[model samples]
Target: MNSARESLEAGYARARQDAARSLETKAGAVGAIATEGAGRDIGSTLLTMDSRLASLRRHSHDYADDLFRWHTVLQWLGWLALALIALKSFLYVLALELFHSDERMTLGFDDAQPIEGSYRTGAQLAIDRHFPHPLITRKQLSNADNHLVLAPWPGSSPLVRIIRRRYFFFARGSLLEDGGRVATVADTARGMVASAGGGQSIVEWTLREGEQVIFRYKDFFGASDNVSLRSELSLRLSTLLFGRVIFHSARCDSGEGRLLLKASVEAVDQAQLRAIPLERMIAWSRHAQFTVHSGRTPWKTLVNGFTLVRRDRGDGQHGLILVSSEDTGANTGSLRYLKRIFSSIF
Candidate 1:
């Protein structure tokens, strides 16, 4: 600004000097017997005046150009700031969605033949003809897979179904109603074994080398009382999405044989997951990871898989059904993500 002002003022001063000189020459020519010789060439004088006027115009243009450049620079900076703000807002929204989410998973039992169905998360789940709702009752099933495992879909909005959603299981001559016992689950060559009650009831499962494509729990219903069990089994292995998962819930109903399970779940390993997805988009639910452990040593450690202990004698007595969310050992992954988010915000 200072430079422009100085240059512009100099240009005006030069023009004024030329005009004054020209006026003096013209005055001499107007007088009779003029003193100044030839009144200083009129053509030369006019040329000088024109040149000075041009220089003034150029200085004015330069000042205007400088102002215009500053304006453009400011506009670009403003736009950049706004774009950054928008991007940050979008990321925060996605994080909040994951936090508020409670993925749905429902694993139950049903009788009666299932209605015709497809294999898509958004497709209608084939409803059991005898039982229409999502329930598990160990009754006589007619030509249908008894286990009803609803797939885990983190995409579904729990808020939409928040009115009041609860699941139920009716067990006749089964331990599901009794909440079972707390036992140690071990993975051995014989099969996956869940031992509780000092070896009173046994639950075991075995799998082949490959994954199973199509199988039903009813076919092996009388075979075992265990599903796919693994070691250091975190929810990370599963195809899970939205949700700050806290704890997982599972129920086992042993009926046909003294709660006697000696079959391998690996045979139909794909089947349980398939059943979960069996009515996913249609039913929406999600649980399978557990923090329940052997009652012998409380809070010290949890058995690798589901714990099968004696029946609950009182309301909060008996076994370990609930897993504390604050358990760092069980919730390492969940806590890490939460910590990262809060750290950025605060």
Candidate 2:
């Protein structure tokens, strides 16, 4: 815009100079004619030329004013756009860094009603029930809990809602980042599983004699799904993945610097889900499991969801595969849908 204005102004100055020089030459001619006593007849013509030159100058000035106004407006709009982009970026970063919250598993014994049986011993019985073979010593884990404490995961809040709605890519990138490191396609699959698996408690367990508390999957989250979890690691998921799998029930035992985790994957069919009181769609999604048809249409197979697992124990999805998405139930456009899309693809 500035360049165009300068070019126009320069052209106008050159034209004005040329017109002035021509007028001076004409004036000399008129003087000569007057000296010959023949200029009186053309004096009105010179007046008309002068009026036309003034009009041209006025129009050139007006043109420059209009061009300058346009340039200013364009510059303002450009700055406004840049400012909006920067604001969005700042909000996104703030949401990720400032808003992440964490809660861990602990013996909330201070509830202070009245103590009955030993909660730690009760925790032991619960673990034994979940794992008939007992992978850990009775001394390792005695804490009663489950459904990996949603630590470092944003809870229900206004900022979280805004991020999900307006700044979703930031959240998505963070979720994928949860999937640890990746070097090969196999490593990528493992990282993706870890991402989908979601957050856990600070009390990481090792099957050996460790001072951490044990919260079996049953005590916490297994009751919601009503499916019996197997004890051995990766005991249930040894086949192909043709649906978005939710590692809803995982029994992880930390052993010898390695984690042995077991879980079952289920894809929910909301349509066939039976409504339960206020739960409605949520109840259906929770109670039911659906199968995806991975037939001739690879596109549908992908859209529906699936995982590509290698035929090795240590190759895919770490020791277990599960991805969790917030099931904020609704008619459509839930976080669950986004989780399904991402978990299926990666």
Candidate 3:
């Protein structure tokens, strides 16, 4: 009987040892799984950091390129200014010797009035006549924000004068300097701030008689459209320097004259002026117009509503005209004409 009890006790002790071994094996497997999961998580985090760093590097490289270009332009402007001073001195001497000695002769004072008068008259006629030709009839939409009239290009050579005017407008707004560079602006204190995709955070404020506004496309450098961002950038910069701010952009729509275009006017301050580096102030002049078409054209005939007339006076003479007429409500004459034309066809 004692021998049988000893055998049973020995069997129970062996069973307990086996159970302890099984528990230890399970605990080790759980620990191994936990360690492997943590390692995978660390790897994922490192990859994300590397991607962000690459983007930041690209932005820095672009910023450096813009700064170099701006510096070069400033150097060129300095040389040009010296040349202009010398020319003015020679003209002054010529005027004194050729004309009367007692009377003061002005270089371009007499010529200014006739050009201004013609511009005003031409703009008024363009609006009243409603000519549909792209060259003659740029319809003045009722919802238009700003009206500008540029003086006719002077001198016999229109190409040279036009080039000068174009450069003058471009340099004035930093548009020439950094307009080609995307929406990203360099902030020394804060690394680089860019909008996701093509949207930006806008601040709204009321504008007075002479303020500047910027109009930016939603997808300026997208694969879908080939619209140039430079024209609008140059126009915005030119207007801001010489006129008031009025932001306008076309909205998407299916039918003809459905949404037309949206306008946003904002007041510019010193902070905004100081923020942009590429814009150089050459001289302030009025009569600036710029337009950018959104790629999505709903109707087959995309009739534009924004009107700021550009007249080419043969021999390289071109001018932009703006009319200060009555705001005659939102139901503009152009919209009425569209309804009349579309009603008969559709």
Candidate 4:
């Protein structure tokens, strides 16, 4: 009886052990399923975060492109504004020229009426007009019927005075009488002339009749220390009263004297004399100085020394004179004729 009871108890114990084993295996399978589900959830969350980050990067790139375009547009607009400003300034200058007119008429040379005395006086007048400080006094040496000689006064410099011993030869040629108008040509010659001393220069005029041409020879001599600095400047000032036009051409050295070569063509309508303002005429005259010095070296340096003024004339004609180096003491000439022709138009 005892043995059968023990075998039955043992079988019961074995059954309990087997049941425990089966339960452990089923628990393990369930645990594995739960782990897999958790892994899937985590993977799905990571994928969602990655997609959001990519969208943000795309948005940032789009914003950067937009900012770049905006910057480019602003830069272009800025350049356009500058160009417009320059254009307006140019138009203003053109407007001034179209309206203003005041004319000064210089009497042409006449042959018949006592031109001998006139020529002598005119020569003196030209010298006085050109040289504010005369280094020598001029004396009339000969006043014959057809020929005249002007004696040179003692110059300030002994060397120049000694050189001025030569006589100034003058001769009157045939005159052209065009109806009421008369133009006379005079020939002048001077030999053995020396430096004026200091920075002074002499411009001798030779007028020929048939060609209706005037030749001006400018002689300059440097200081004793700068004898090597010798130069001859020349220019032709031609005017045709019938055409109401004047032309000027000059050749000068490389230094401060370069202003001698500046020349330009300018015209104003004769009919619009009353409408142009004095200031406008003055500005035009001043601006025209640049036309002469547009190219070339050294003389261009004097561009800063220009001055413009409208002469107060009681007559109906308005006159403009652009003076370069207004302080006569400076080393420059009075560009009066230049301003006058440019201020008037036919």
Write down the TM-score of every candidate. Answer: 0.20, 0.21, 0.27, 0.25
For model 3, the superposed segments whose C-alpha errors exceed 4 Å read: 1-9, 78-346
* Cα lDDT tens digits for candidate 4, 274-345: 232122221121111111111213343333222222233334233222211113333222222234333322
Q: All models: lDDT?
A: 0.29, 0.30, 0.29, 0.30
* Candidate order (lDDT): 4, 2, 1, 3
Question: Lowest summed-lDDT stretch of 10 residues in model 4?
Answer: 112-121
C-alpha lDDT (0 to 100) for residue 269 of candidate 1: 22
Against the true structure, whose TM-score is highest? Answer: 3
> Each model's number of backbone clashes?
19, 5, 10, 5
Give the TM-score ranking, best first. 3, 4, 2, 1
lDDT of 2 by residue, 52-126 (tens): 999999999999999999999999998996784455434422322221111121111111122111111111122
**Lowest lDDT 10-residue stretch of candidate 2:** 115-124
> What digit string (tens of lDDT, one per residue) describes model 3 on residues 98-126?
32222222111112111111111111111
Q: Between the candidate structures 2 and 3, which one is better when assessed by TM-score?
A: 3
Runs of candidate 4 with Cα error greater than 4 angstroms are 1-12, 85-346
- Preferred candidate (TM-score higher): 1 or 3: 3
* Model 1 lDDT per residue over 1-346, tens place: 9999999999999999999999998887677344343456666788899999999999999989999999999999989866844554344333323322322321211121121111111111222222212222223223233454332222222322122131123222212211264434321112111222321222212212121112222111222233221111122212122221221212222211111121221222222232211111111112122121222222322222122112222332121111111212332222233333322211
Q: Relative to the unseen true structure, what is the C-alpha lDDT of residue 167 in candidate 3, on a scale of 0 to 100?
A: 14
Between candidates 1 and 4, name the one with more favorable lDDT. 4
